[model samples]
Target: MTELNFPALGRQPTGCPPARGVLVCWLAADGSQVHVGDRLAEVRVADDRFGRRIGWVSALATGTLWHQVRAGEVLTAGAVVGLID
Candidate 1:
């Protein structure tokens, strides 16, 4: 099985802190088949200057999706969001 992790969004401009975000929603359903680059979920990131911004999380492999995180959950860089098997 392959893990689907929340991707790092780089550093903040002011203090160079890592970006933190929340899981907005899942675009792909659990147990659904997905391919590489498929949109898996939506995330809302807290930006210092830009406020909150929405982002899409994509699948890294082709397999059945199993969610490890739920909507509205807090997220950090490299957090395990799901699994593909």
Candidate 2:
């Protein structure tokens, strides 16, 4: 398993949830082959009263996209939401 992990959300100067967000959408389809630097999915984090924070998870290595996360699913920091190959 490639094991795609969640990336850190914003600077988050304070040591808060490293990657707290909801899996909004998937740019690449499950089981689809992806290249390096390809956008995997979009995550939305309800940071504060200002607005929701958005982040993108990208593929680190060229391989097949095997998503371990689902749309609208809320996840925490450092969570392994997917895998490659």
Candidate 3:
């Protein structure tokens, strides 16, 4: 079992494609140990053009980063940001 984090809400960097209204940022460097309730990523939410924070990304279970992800990237449910080793 692996865990993924939600991207934090904030300004979108210039040149980077706007996250489909959502983004995910990993806490660990691609591959790392993850524990329950561990902060994995930050999720950004927007309300009528005004960006707001939804919440912090947490790990569902202990696991490892299976795939590498970059900042300011949109993430969908079960996107497989990483896999537990």
Best by TM-score: 1
**What TM-score number comes out for model 3?**
0.57
Model 3 lDDT per residue over 63-82, tens place? 66555566676664345455
**lDDT of residue 29 for candidate 3:** 60
Number of clashes found in candidate 1:
0
Give the range of the ten consecutive residues with the poorest summed lDDT in model 1.
8-17
Q: What is candidate 1's TM-score against the reference?
A: 0.86
Full ranking by TM-score: 1, 2, 3
Stretches off by above 4 angstroms in model 3 are: 3-19, 49-51, 76-78
Cα error, candidate 3, residue 1 (Å): 3.8
lDDT of each: 0.87, 0.81, 0.58
- TM-score-wise, the better of 1 and 2 is 1
Q: For residue 73, give model 2's deviation from the true position in Å.
A: 0.4
Instruction: Encode model 1's per-residue lDDT on 1-85: one tens digit a residue.
Output: 9998886655656666567899989999999999999999998888777787888889889999999999999988779999999
TM, every model: 0.86, 0.83, 0.57
lDDT of 2 at 19: 49
Ranking by lDDT: 1, 2, 3
